[model samples]
Every structure is written in C-alpha cells, then in structure tokens.
Target chain A: MSSLIVASIYQQVINDVIHNIQRDFEDSGVDVSVLNELQQLWETKIIQSRVTNFPPEDDKNQLEQEEDMENSSKRGTNKQKAKARSKSYNQNLSVGNINQDESEDELSDANSVVSNKYPENETKFTGQSAASLASIINTSNTNNMSANTGYPLSPSQRKNNAFEEDYDDQNSSTDDESQNQPLSTRAPQFLASGVNAPLASMSPMMGQRNLDQAQQNSSKINDLLNNNATGNDYMYQSLGSNSLANNNSQDTKKPYLPQNDGCDDPISVWKIFLAERKLKQLNSANKLDSTEQNKDFNMTISQVDGDNSENGGDITEHMVLCQYDKVSRTKNKWKCVLKDGIMLVNGRNYLFHKANGDFEW
Target chain B: MSQYYELYRTSTLGFALTDSLDELIQAGHITPQLAIRVLMQYDKSIAEALTNHVKARATIKGSLKTYRFCDDVWTFIISNPNFKFENEVVSADKVKIVACNARRPDEA
Candidate 1:
C-alpha cells in the first residue's frame, strides 16, 4: 500500500502557509475573502489532481468535527466563519455537479448565477457591512471560475471593452454596438482610434513627412498582416516536415527586414520583439517534436534491450526530495543518509523520516 | 528572514500549487507579486513540516548512474533502486535524488 502520510503532510503545509500569510494579507490591505478563496482553490486543485489518495469525505468531515469540538471554546467565531465558507463552497460544487451533464455554455451560465448569488451568501454570514463586500466577492468568484476553467479569453475581452469605454466616451454608443461584433471586426477600429488619438494631439508643425511616414507604416502593417495569415497556414504544414525547411522559410519571409535597421525607433523595436517571439514559438514547437520522437525511440530501445545493465538507460520519472545527513564516497561506491524525504515512485508518493542509501557509481 | 531553497518547487506538490497560482494570476484574481509571496511561504512551510512532522524511515540501494555536487547541493541519479519501507519494498527503474544542505545558508 502507498504511504498514508501524504494527506496530512499536505494539510499541514496548507494550514502553515495560510497561517503564516495572514499578517501579510492584512499588511497588503487585500480583503480576507481573497485569502480564503486562495485556500479553497488550492484544496480544490489538489483534490482534483488525484496525485495522492485522500481519505473519504465522511472520514474527513469526522476529523474536522473532532478538531472543531476540541477548539470550539477558544475559536468559536473562526469556526463559524469556516462553516459558512465550507457551506458556500459545497453549494458551488453541487451546482457544478448538477450541471455536469449540461452543455458547456449552460454550465458556465450556472456558474455565473452561483457567482452572483455569492454576495448574498456572504451577507447572510457576515450580517453587517456585507453590502460593501458584495462586489468584491462577485468579481472574485467570476475570476476564480475563469482561472479554474482555463478559458480567460472571455473575461479579458470584457476587460478590453470596459477599457475602451473608459477611454473613448464620444464613441460609447458605437462601442456598445461594436461589443456585439466579432473581435476580428472590432479590433481594427480599436487600433485605428488608438492611432488617431495621438496624431490628433500632435501639432501640425510636426510636419507632413511624419504623416507620410505614418501612412507608410500603416501600409507596412497591412503587408505584415497578410504575410502572417499565409505564414500561419504554412506553419500548420511545416509541422510534418523537418526543422531545416521551417528555418529556410523563415529566412525567405523577410519583407520587414529593413525595419530592423532602425533599432532606435520604438516601432521597429516592437516589431523586432514580435518577430523574435514568433521565431521562438516556432523553434520551441519543433524542439518539442524532436524531444518527443527521441523519447519514443529511447522507449523502444529500452524495451528491446531488456534490463541488460543497471545504468544502461536514461533516468525515468522517479524522484526524491530530501536533505542529506552525510554523503561519503570511496572509489566508485557511495553512501548517504537522507532525512525528511518525500519519495515518488511509479505514481505513489511516500514520506520517510530517514533514508539510508548505498550505491555504486 | 531565513532563506530556503526553491528547488522543491519542482516536486509534485509544489507543481500543483504553482499551477493553481498560475490560474489565479491568469484570471486576475491575484497579482503575480502575491503568488511569489505564497510560493515563498510554501517553501518555508513544507521544509519545516517535512523536518518536524515526518517520522517514517526507509532504506534504498541502487547503482548510481550519475552524481554531481555543485553550489552546496547534491544531485544523484540512481538506477534500479529498491526502497525498503516499513511494511513493503518499492522499486523503480531510476530515481533522481535532489538533496539540499541540511544546514540553512544563514546558519552556515
């Protein structure tokens, strides 16, 4: 059986971190609710990952009840607050469970409803001054969901709309309509307005040459966009070919190479950064493919070789985190005393207070 | 403030916490600065917890595939290792050992 100590170890770590950071939270002037949300999110993530088995819910509740009973007199208010938090958390989980079979859109909608109701739940728990806390709690809940679901695009788009409204009051009516349009259609207008704002602020004495340059830059941007569209489609095909072909294509697609000469110009600098980022992404993707192929080839070779020598193959995934009491080596042999270690083997995690290791290099 | 090694952040538990923190940051729930503070707290907490709370003992034997000592840290790659726990023996084809100095840098 796997070691049962991991659950308590993790629990103790969470408690320690929360306890230690309480003062820091207060010092930073962030609401306590965010801290509680952090703890809740951490626990939910750990439980979801299933890296190690935790006790069943009934047993866990029993343990918490026992602890509550023992400390009820000293920390009664804290216990009550914890109870409220857990109750709300359970409701959130139940909502998710009930909507699990629904479409993703419906599930997200249900989550939003629960998020809206969260402030009322907090109000009931806190009694006074909850009206002020309601908005923060609501945003926290929505943001928490966005984090959990791994789809932050919608929230960011909403933020961009809010930003646009704040900056462009005259265009607010058009902004409301644009918000309903697809991002591709909306983005160009946003960029155009952004460009026009600075130009309008500049004095005419800045010269027609500057205006002409701006027009030239806009044309160059259009060319870059067209290049990007074709480059992306080619990238999809390049994944099947070798890295050399990808590099050759990257070299040939240098229409904007002249801009790199103007290193002092901010626009050119930004363009260089963007180009480098795209190149890095492409190179990293190719590296991932090669590494994956190497891994597969190594696995096949290992299988064929069949345990011929102890040190014949690459290191597998097993790992140990510990402190050494002493490490002594003689010739090619090695010995060490490892203390307070967590060992991960196969898929299970084990904790050891002391470990004696004997090995030959 | 005592300094602790951030190496354990690569472990499974630390990786889980880091992933959670990343999600929170991406959602704009917490700032990257706050996440760094939380991770620092985690490093101290787990190190202390492991030292003071853990009580199990084990013995392992293997052939050391590679060993390196640098900047007061030990990295050992052991092949075909067998771990003898209290009740059972577990074996792995290979295991990497990351051992930080038992003494804190401040103390040293």
Candidate 2:
C-alpha cells in the first residue's frame, strides 16, 4: 500500500519572493537563480499546510511573509521604490543589522555607510521562513503586524475552522431542536463531545493574564529607542511565481493536537479572538503612557494620512487605525473587519456606530 | 476671525475642488459660472486671503470647509483611500487616534 500528498503556495507569491531575491542577488545571477528555486521549493510546503488546515510554526512564515511584502509593495514603481533596498542604503548605519549580512555583494563598503536615520539599539523580531500559507494564517499573527482589533481576517478563523469540508456532514445534521436553539444555551460547542463544561457563566476574561500584550508594549518601546519605526511596518506579502520540486521524499508527520470536534463552543472561539483584543487595549494604554514619555513616538506610530506613495514621496504610513463594527451576516455570527470601521466627519477621528451595526455620517 | 483664517489659509495641503460655481461664489471665492481653470490659474491670492482669515482665531473653533489633499492632483486628493483622522497634540495634553474619512456636505 502507498499514499501521496502535496502542498503549495500561490505561484505568484513564490515569484514575488524570488523576484526580490533575484534583485538582492543581482550581481550573482546563478546564486539568485538557486535561491529563487529554493524559495519556490519551500512554498510547496506552505500549500501543504493549507490543505492540512493546520498552522505552520509561526516564526518561519513570518519572515518569508515580511520579506515578500517589502519586495512586492515597492514593486512596479521604478524610481520610487525603497532606497534601502540598495546595499548602499544601510552601508553607513548601525551595527549587528541582520539585513546587512544577507546583503552579501557589498560587504566591503559597509564599513563607511553608517546611518543615523535608523536609530541604533532597535530590537527586531525574526520569524521562520514559511514554506506554507496555512502556517501564517492564524487570526492574530503577522510579520509586520501588531495585533489590531481594527482590521480583521476577512474569512475569519472561526469560519475557516468551522467550515472545513470534513465537518460539514457531522455538523449540518444536528437534531432540529439543537439547530433552532439560541446560541447561549449551549456551553460546550467547540468542546469535543465527552468534554465537560468548565463552569456555566464562568468569567473567561477574569483568570488569565495577557503576558504577550504586556511584552509587546515593552518591545514597542524598545523599537522606538532603537529605530524610527513606530509600527507602520504592517503589510501582507505579495504573490510571486516559482516551480516546486518533488515532495515524494518529504516528511509529513502532523503535530499531535486536538481536532475540531465541534460539539459547539462559542466561548472558546470568542475568547481566542478577544485574546488579541485585550492585547490591543493594553498596547493602546501603554502606547499612551509612552506617548507621554515621547511625543515623537506617538506621532510616528499614528501618522496615517495623506501620503500617497503614487505621488513620488518617500513617506511610509506610520499607522492607520480602523475599527469595524460587528455585523451579522450569518446565523448568530458577525464579521469583524476594518473596512467596516466607520469614519468621522469634520476631519475628526471619531465614528458612531450602533449595536446592530448601523452607522451615521 | 481674519487672523484665524490666515493661520489656516489655503496652503498646498488645503487645496480641494468645488463641484459648483454657485458654492464658490456664495463663499465669495469666485463669481457665478466662471471657468474653474480660469479661477485656478488666477487664485494664488485666495490662499493668502484664507491665511489672513485663519490667523484671526482666538480658539480653534468653527472650521471652514476646504479640501485638504495629499497633492495638487485632483484624483490623488479625492480618491477615497481609507484615512485615519489622527488628532495630533500641539501640546501633549490631548492626543488620540481615531478613524476619520468623511467630507462634510459643503466640502463634498
């Protein structure tokens, strides 16, 4: 007996990442071709994750995603692309910059090009080079992103998990009584059958401490001290093209974990979503506190207006915060996304929305 | 009041297109049905006049309607890209971030 499986990343994404690698290694066309091919091979693994419906280990996906985005966003525009892409941009600047070493062609000139533009002492995050898209699709994780309650995953996490093809038969055929029952009555939805309720009316928000949010606040402070970026780095990777190799010899052991049994647990999903929300609140308060410490940082983080790169400007958006309302599109479900964020008039940063997802100009 | 307008006059950032000559004439920036191209080519003084109006402010209240654009290009300024109406602090006392992307009826 024998079996087979294959994974994929969009050909466009591979092409996009490889294209940047090509530019970075322009002087060494052979190595550029080799690395481009390597990135393509890696992308096949990503497509596999999507098929398996499990996330990849976070860090690798994050890095590939970041690099892929930086390359893509600056693409098409010839003169207006990032100056920092050239080896010369970082040549004069800070020490121990990881991007410097990867930029191999001009290592000798690096000694003289120290830059004061990017403040020294910046702390940076590194993620795994992702081979699969599913690994990077978690509701809260992004390479350049700080958890924003503002913009949301369009086909959100719950929807992705709940609608997996395998679960359709089992879930759709629930007894009529259960189908018609109001959502609140069931306390054990996503909980696997035989898993008992922890407690009714239990305050899920009360017990756990959000250590990650606290840490993110401190890291942001570290980022300001080290570099000028106050969180304008948020982006999604662009799609590129490449050819993947044979996966017949690849290892495909799945990490042991609970599968979605779907007995029905709204609290679990809601709590997971709110984990980032709580983090956002903490980060906002902490940002306010830090703004008192440094106005420059606040301005840097929140200055998201009127700079269209199409206008031949070098400015990057520092931040453009949005908050979408909860809108019901399906049974007892709402899409929480940022385009839903109502905008304010009078050039004011305010919006008024109701519980029913209505908005007034 | 004149001084306030001076402070907030029609700088490059405050440039916008008006849909009607009636509105422009009503605001006294132009006469009825006059060609916009003629008005645009001739209105270097409007900014100067508006600046004089802006400098008269005692407090930052009652804003006049004007189009603030990223550039002088019409499409770049008016294309409804999402904007965050971030309120910056002149003094560090009142700073906040909010989503703001609407034009008042007059400006629209």
Candidate 3:
C-alpha cells in the first residue's frame, strides 16, 4: 500500500515536471525527452528502493500543508478584490466562481506556485516578478469548462454578442460608399471586422517583417489596430475559442521569456545567422574597407583594432550570440545550433566556455 | 548514504534543476547541503547566480570568464559525438568530478 502511494506521488511529480517542461520549451528547439530520461531514472530509483525493502519517502502530506498555507494567504486577498470587482461591475456570484475555478487550475498547472492576477507584481517564485513567470506559464486552458460552461457562460457570451453588435454598429457608421462593409452573415462578420486585414493575408515572412518594421515605426497605431481587431465577437463557441479569447485578454503575456537560454526569438536567431554568414564572406574576401556590404546584411558590425602597435594583431569583437557546432567545421555554417551556446540574460552573459565545454557566467 | 554517490549535479537537470534538487532532498536521496554545494560550484559566478535568483542585475567582483588564447597552449576540443562525460564518486569526503574523454566507441 505504501509503495502504491509512493508510485502515485512520484507519478504526480513526473506529470507536473513534464507539464512545466512543455510550457518552458513550447517553441524552442530544446529536446524535452531529456525529462523522460530523468523520469525513467526516478522510476529506477523507486524500483531500487522497493527491491531493497526501502520505499521512497513520502513528502505528499508536507507538500500539501505548504501549498495550503500558500493558498489561503493568496485566496484571502483574491476573494476581497474579486468581491469588490464583481460588485462594481454588477456581476453575480457565477463570475466569481468561474474566476476561482480558473485560478485554481493555474495553481495546479504551475505546480502550486500560486499565480495571481497582476502579472507585473512580484511573483512568489524566489524573487522573480509575476510577469517573468506568466510569460512562460501556459494559463489558457485552466478553466474548468465542464462545470461552468453551460450555465455561467451565457451572460459572457451575450456580452460578446453585444460586443459584435457594437462592431456592426461601427461598420454601419462608416461611409456608406466604402467597399469594406460588414457582411450580413455572422461567420463573415468575423472576417470582415478588420480582423483578417491585408497584413494577415500576406506571406508570414513578409507579414513578420512588415509587422516588425511597423512596430518600430508606429507602435501606437499597431497596438490600436491589434486591440480593435481582437475585440470583435467570435462566431464559434468551442473550448479552444474560449481559451483563445482568454489569451487575447491577457495581452501582456508572451508565449516565451527572453531568458539567457539559447532559445530566444527564432527570428532574432535567423537574423544573426544570416548576418554572421555575410560577415564571414566579407572577412574571407578582404572587403573590410567598404561599409556598403555591411548595410546589405542589415546587421551592425563594430570592428575594434586589437592593438595599433602590434604588426599581426587580430581584430577581436565578441560574437553577439555563440551557438556551438559539434562538427567544428560547421561552426561557420549559417544554421543556428543553440543546444550548447552562449546566452545573454538580464545583462549577464552565460557563455559556453570553449575550453571546458561547460556553460559559465 | 556515504557509499552511494551522486552521478548527476543539480545543474545538469537544466531549467528544472532547482525544483528537482528540492524534490531529491525531500525524497531523502541527498541532503540539502549537497544540493547547495553543487549549485554553488556549478558556475561560481556571483552576478549570474544573483541575476538568476532575482530578475535584477548587479555588478560583482568577478564577472563571467572568457578565453581567447592567441597561442596553441590550450586546444579547443570541438564537440564530437565521442565526447563522453563520466561522473563518478570515489570515496566519502572526496568529491564527485566530471571527466570527459574524447574517443570514439570503435577506437582501438
């Protein structure tokens, strides 16, 4: 019986660990199967402990106590705030119940780390901020849909339908002669509400470049357009769409954080890879005199002469990002191998020491 | 407890290292001090550790170390499939060290 309990506890731990790993490595190239290997190791440890007539110690009770303590404090404050908000919005107890169910799901998903509403506030993790944690924690599917979807959702969906009417109202308010008119059909209303604009229709690469450039040029306009587009009503009412709506509401939440880990913005890595290739070509061809080619690469190259006095002094500048290539010959290759690489996080550069083959900062 | 040595350090577990160490300690696999020592010696950077602990950055006495040798005194061992790392614990009071050997499996 003790072994069974132990197994269940270990399984829960493993499941929680895998979920966290999935959340952290969502869009990265990091092989998450390493966690599986670690899981197997734990299983072996459990088996070894069992065979030796010594079961793995159970800390489930203790963990539960710590979690309960953590939850009560957070729950108290959240209840007060939730009560005040519901009263001001003239919302009923159903909304409060739905929000409670969502936060509980978030707590379990984050391994009882206790995620609060205000993401920018200081998080409960050691000393990190809530935004830093929220960026990585997947909080979209935490709603207990089965319990609250049928009854409590009608009011919210009505609100959303009302919101759609507003979009229609605005569309009709526009110049009557304009070709961009709101379609009478409900499904087409979503597509016509400026949600699927010309920019979204462009190829992903062009769209991304245009979006980046647009953001750099006029961030306010970009944000306004995004807000206007996503605020429209949805035609479908599936769980997936509901979660997507939640994600849209949390605009500040990024799918990933800019940690020193090599899995940064894939676009940034691609840009660096292209820039490095161009730099290598220029270096090999003795074309350092011209700054024109550098402009073609679209990367800033700052060259500092090592020493003026030394005849054979080599020019030295730190590579903005270093990704290790197992095949040394391929180190100059354009593809990024970020598995073992130098990552700069929070201003401290965690470098892959070429000499020791270990990450050092 | 003294006879069994830790084959893996806390840092080797990657991003989940901290939580894994805590679990291992709670499970009685290893003491908390051992985990702390492993973390302390993993990279040994005051600034990086502090920044990792807190989201804020600070300047410390020793920054990250870098090697840009002009001479051939130190040869850069390129990452090869044969680069095998063996971590072993010899005796109690002695530390577990990682020894890397660059040899292919088919090599005589």
Q: Which one wins on lDDT?
A: 1
Q: Report lDDT (CA) for all predictions.
A: 0.47, 0.22, 0.25
Give the range where candidate 1 chain B is weakest over 10 consecutive residues by summed lDDT.
B23-32
TM per candidate, chain B: 0.94, 0.22, 0.28
Error of 3 at A237 (Å): 28
Rank by DockQ, descending? 1, 3, 2
**Model 3 Cα displacement at A346 (Å)?**
27
Residue-level lDDT tens digits of model 1 in B1-108:
248777666566775566455433322334444566888899999888887888888999999866766667777778789999888798986687879888766687
Candidate achieving higher lDDT, 1 or 3: 1
Model 3 chain A poorest 10 in a row by lDDT? A144-153
Stretches of model 3 off by over 4 angstroms after superposition? A1-361, B1-108
**Quality class of the docking in candidate 3, CAPRI style:** incorrect
DockQ of 3: 0.05
Chain A TM-score of model 2 comes to 0.17
The TM-score leader among the candidates is 1
- What would the TM-scores of all predictions be? 0.52, 0.18, 0.19
DockQ of each model vs. true complex: 0.37, 0.04, 0.05
Most accurate candidate by DockQ: 1
Least accurate 10 contiguous residues by lDDT in model 3 chain B = B88-97
Candidate 1 ranges beyond 4 A from true positions? A53-315
